[model samples]
Target: MAVAPIIVHPPLGTGGRRVTAHGRILGLAYSDGDVIEFLRRAGLPDAEELLDDPSWVTWRGGRAHHYEAA
Candidate 1:
C-alpha cells in the first residue's frame, strides 16, 4: 500500500505528537486541530479533511484521536 505523505508520529512522554510532511517537521500537535492548522499553514488545500483520509495522514503508535500515551 502507498504511504501517506503526512505522518503524525506517536505522542511524546510529555505530550503531543510530532507532525511531519515528507520529513519536514511542521510542528508539535496536541490535538487534531493543531495538525490541521499546521497543514493549512503548509498549504494543504483541505487540511481538516486530511485527518480522516488514510491516504493523506498516517497516525503512528496510537489510535487516531486518542492523545493519551500509555
Candidate 2:
C-alpha cells in the first residue's frame, strides 16, 4: 500500500478536521474517536491504534489526532 493513504486535514476555522482517503473525502473528525470511527467505516478496524501510524495516516496542519487549531 501507499504511505499515508489516509489524510487528516487541518482543522477548519469553526471546528473539525477533514478526513480523506486517496484524495476522497471520508468525513470530518471533531475528535480522535471520530477519526477512528471514520477509519473503521473505511475498513480499518484498528484505526484507534493506527492513529499514530504514519504509514497509514498523515496528519496535516496540526499534530496527529488533534482536531483543534495549533
lDDT of candidates 1 onward, in order: 0.89, 0.86
lDDT by residue for model 2 over 20-57, one digit each (tens)?
99988999889988888888998989889888888888
- Which stretches of candidate 2 lie above 4 Å from their native place? none
Which stretch of 10 consecutive residues in model 1 shows the poorest summed lDDT?
A: 61-70
Model 2, residue 41: distance off in Å is 0.7
lDDT of 2: 0.86
TM-score of predicted structure 1: 0.91
Candidate 1 local lDDT, 1-70, one digit each (tens): 9989999999888889999999999999989889999999999968988898999989999788766666
